[model samples]
Target chain A: MTKVIAGASMSLDGFIAGPDETGFEHLFRWLGAGDVEVPTANPGHTLRMSAVDAEYLRDQWDNTGAIVVGRRLFDLTGGWGGAHPIGRPVVVVTHEAPTGWEDTPFTFVTDGVTSAIERAKALAGDRWVGVNGGTMARQCLEAGLLDTIGVDLVPVVFGKGVPLFGELANAPVLLGAPEVVVGSGVTHLRYDVLR
Target chain B: MTKVIAGASMSLDGFIAGPDETGFEHLFRWLGAGDVEVPTANPGHTLRMSAVDAEYLRDQWDNTGAIVVGRRLFDLTGGWGGAHPIGRPVVVVTHEAPTGWEDTPFTFVTDGVTSAIERAKALAGDRWVGVNGGTMARQCLEAGLLDTIGVDLVPVVFGKGVPLFGELANAPVLLGAPEVVVGSGVTHLRYDVLR
Candidate 1:
């Protein structure tokens, strides 16, 4: 089974980016360095992560088979910026076929959310397929395509910007209690997908 | 000249809290145990603490000079919770003085933003006077009461909640490029207050 993981770090005030939405400086700050451990056992700021926990994250990253992202995130990263950060297969979800870049090698799926997930699953042999992007993540979640969601909460409030799950077109999707870790006021949480 | 800063975090989906104004679990997660390592270079987070950051934050709970909050936040947090978090002076920017909690020790002065800033500044002394509540933080920014804003972002989108700032008031409060660190996909950045 391919596990679709959606993850992002937001500011304390509920903004992924400022009004301009130009750079990710604020987002990076809240997350600190991924090295900081997440304290899942307790609640509040005292949450801390140990060395063994860090290894678990590192392993997840290494094992992620394929990546699925929306046009928004794909455009923001400049089509993965020449060199794809994640070496595995990358599937970009866009209504229109993107132009300007043919140098890199990745699968660009234009057939909406359902098609993208199917393509990603096929591309992801044994490893899990990771879902990126706000809309695509929500779509996969609503469609019951995702298997897990990893959330890293950064600390800053843009006051307003794009949101994760807007009014669900369908009935609400319920995510279970997440495993939490606290460090530098940034909370790291992960939820296993239901169904 | 005292430099004021505002530190806030939000979800990429542009929501500070969940719908209906009821906060999500992520809200509690972002706060952590309140045991944060206040950046030495950026003392604003810990209100200018000396030790390894944690001590300064711990000390802030007791030694805070004064407290500043917005009208909405004052009503929400104040309405339910009788006593304010810190025992120091509290100045709220509202047309009316709240007579609700005579039991709790809080000074509800309704003079104006400028007067409140002056009064809070004088009392704050070496201790940092914390500004809270989204609306209040904005007013303080407009009134020039804030010295530094310590932002902490979380990774959940409420889609709808009280906005941190909006077109009602837009001011040019400059921010230094934040220092960045990453953990669990959450990036933490610290910006110097440049007024």
Candidate 2:
């Protein structure tokens, strides 16, 4: 079975992004905080992190066969310049698919999260379907389709900003004790969502 | 020199309490989740937890010589039924000091968190002074008076609730990588405030 996982690097105060989309430097400081290099799909772009974090990141990248993300993120990075860092097929959840970007690794779904997840699962097969944070993650979790939650918890307080899973419709969402991986500037916690 | 630390049992989503002040059972579940016995100030009150948690709790309680809390918490538990769990002097920060509580182990500070912390530090001598969550923690952090942050992070997400430190005035407050202690159902993280 293809596991559906939602993942994000969050501040200690539970914000993925600080107010007005600020504080990315603090949230993602671990990306360049160490000596071990973890390269993404983009040529010449690599993350220098601690050996512990490098290993964890490599494993996550290797296991993720496909991705489901919301439209906002798609536009934010200009669709990762057509290649996601995960180096996997991308399924984007959007109302209207963007123009002139066909015959590539990206698949835009016009319907809903359920359909997008279903398509991504088919694309992922036996590996895993990685969901981006914010809207995409919230929809998947609320719909009971998310299997695990991976939080790269950084040691910074953002006070107020975009939350991990914004305004969860059904919550008190309990999770099992996480498989913890302590890195240089981040503590990676992978928790299974309880049924 | 006495260290000032603010601590709380927080959800993974950064809530010190769930919506409507609910979900205490989940927040405090780790206290009763294991076999090792950890005794409180009250003779008859004992917590059962894994050896890991018991040792952590013991170290915390033993090192904390005094506590500072907001008036809200003082009234919430009726001043912990006259005896705090940590077996230390309690300083309550309020607008008006309540009457008839003069001879107890509690002190009321009418000025602010600064005065309350000063009193707690005096009472603590060479030991650590602990500050409670929410308003008290926020004030301490904003004023650059808190030295460390200790979070007993539980595996739960409350969609909306009282945050760990509500709306920090000066944010993007970076911290050192935490000293992580993994327990049965909780992860105790102690982080030093970066200058």
Candidate 3:
């Protein structure tokens, strides 16, 4: 069975980002000093993350095969900003084609969720597929195409903004009890898809 | 009035660190981007806080004269290990001094929350005091010591863990509507201390 994992960070109040995505430091602080280390530009503030935490994250990425993302995610992700780190095949599900990165050879399809996922599975072969955006991830969930849903629960709460499963009127998506994994107050939860 | 701003990245479920506190990456992914550049041990993943965001954060810090944290926060924070970036006076409210950073110049107080805060304020000399840590933050909240509460709500939820506020008998804390700031999902909320 081809497994699709919806892995993303969320705030304490059930929001993915704030109104304009401000106060993003809360997200980085959740990463602790270890997940990603950036020297404070202020030079007056110090931060650090546990090394043991970093190794754990690298392992999670190893379980994936291909990645599927939406236009919003594709745009915000800085287009790998001239570099592709994951190296896995990427399938972007979008209504419009992105400029510049067209040379990178990523598959662009407007065939909606199912078709893009099918192509991603084909490219992924025997590996797990990573569902990369909240809305697109919800679409896959609505279609009952997801194999696994991974939610990393962060500790802070944004009163409002985009939600993980933004306003879908589709059929109910049953989820299993999430198995919890803790790192830097970011809880990694996994729910297996049945039916 | 010295105003200290305390902030951190959090998950949707209110978890500071997931199960092992080492496996989750979504918070790191959402944060530490170009806006909040987080430099990773991996040269490839190093990031820097965007000037806009950095300036915003710095502006928040500028209002404070001292910082107050609890025992757990101090311990979990790796004692600002190897890099105590903030030169401002730091007051750690703990039952006992934590090991390792004993040599660090920060004041380690083995006293109650109120006393520690007062001492910090005295040292601050007209500067505002910033308090971090769930227990101490709550303590200040309960004692009606805090003038304002700033919440940088990250979007995610953990079913359980150290709560933002522990059990306080029927007393309620009132928060004002939050203001949208930066990024895709971060929001800043304000709360007036209404005992």
Candidate 4:
């Protein structure tokens, strides 16, 4: 069975990004905090992380076959400047599919999150459907389609910013105690969404 | 040297309480998730927690000699109804000291967080000063008096609630990677505040 997981680097105060879309340096500092190097799907864009995090990321990328992202993040990152760093097919949830991209690994879903996730799952096979962006994660969570929450918990306080799952409609969403793995400057927490 | 530490049982999304002041049951479920019984200052109030958390709580209580709180929480818990659960004296930071509560473990400080903590430290001697409530913690952190951030992270998402440090004035407060302790229903993270 393919599981849908929401993944992001969050601050100790639970923000994925600081106000004005800042604080990315602190959030993603762990990506370069150590000596071990892990190559990304993008050419010449390898990530250097702690050995523990490198192994963790390697395992995650190995198991995550496809990714589901919101149009905001897709546009913000300019569609990851081409291929996503995770080397997985991306199923974008947008009202309208963007043009000028033909033979890429991007599938633009002109529907809602549910349809986008279904398409991603079909592409994922027995692997996982990785979800990105707070809006996308919240939609998947509220729809009960999110299986896991993968937070690379950084040690910083962004008083206000983009939350991992922003303004959840069905809140008090119970989750299992996270499987914790402490890295150099980040603690990886994998929480299972309870039914 | 006495350390100033802020402690709270926070939701995964950094909330100390849920919307409408709800979600305490989920936040504190770990206090009764196991069989190890830890007695509080109140004769009849004992907490049953997993062995690891019980030890952690015992050590924290043993090390914490004085607790500082905000007036809102002091009135909310009705002054803990008596002595604090950790059997420590409480120094409440308030605009005005309340009357009718003399010779008790509670001391009302009408000055500020710095004065309150100073008084608490004088009362604490060599032991640590524990700061409670988001407002109190935020003040201490901003004043550069906070030494550690002790977060008992519960596995629940409270979409809207009182944050651990609500609306931080000095954000991007970087912290050291936390010392992680995974309990049955909680994960105790001890993060040192970087000066």
**Top candidate by lDDT:** 2
C-alpha TM-scores of all predictions: 0.61, 0.99, 0.48, 0.99
If both were scored by lDDT, which would come out higher, candidate 1 or candidate 4?
A: 4
Candidate 1's DockQ = 0.12
Task: Give the residue spans of candidate 1 off by over 4 A.
Answer: A7-21, A24-61, A71-85, A94-105, A108-111, A147-159, A164-195, B1-16, B24-60, B77-82, B98-104, B108-111, B142-144, B148-156, B165-195
Off by over 4 Å in 3: A35-49, A99-105, B1-195
What DockQ do you compute for every candidate structure? 0.12, 0.88, 0.04, 0.87
Docking class of 1: incorrect
lDDT of 2 by residue, A1-195 (tens): 789999999999899999999999988999999999888888868889999999999999889999999999989989898799878999999999988889889999999999999999999989999999688888998999999999999999999999999678888999999999999999999999999
What is the CA-based DockQ of model 4? 0.87
Candidate number with greatest DockQ: 2
* lDDT of candidate 1 over B115-193, digit per residue (tens): 7667666767766667766666677766656656654434344555656554224333444445443323123444554
* C-alpha RMSD values across all candidates: 10.5, 0.8, 17.5, 0.8
TM-score of model number 3 = 0.48
Q: Write the per-residue lDDT of candidate 3 for residues B10-72, one digit (tens) a residue.
A: 444344443445313543333454556544323454445656555555665566677888877
lDDT of 1 by residue, A90-160 (tens): 78887787676565556788878889878888888777888876677778877878777776655443545
Q: Which is better, 3 or 4, measured by DockQ? A: 4
lDDT of 1: 0.57
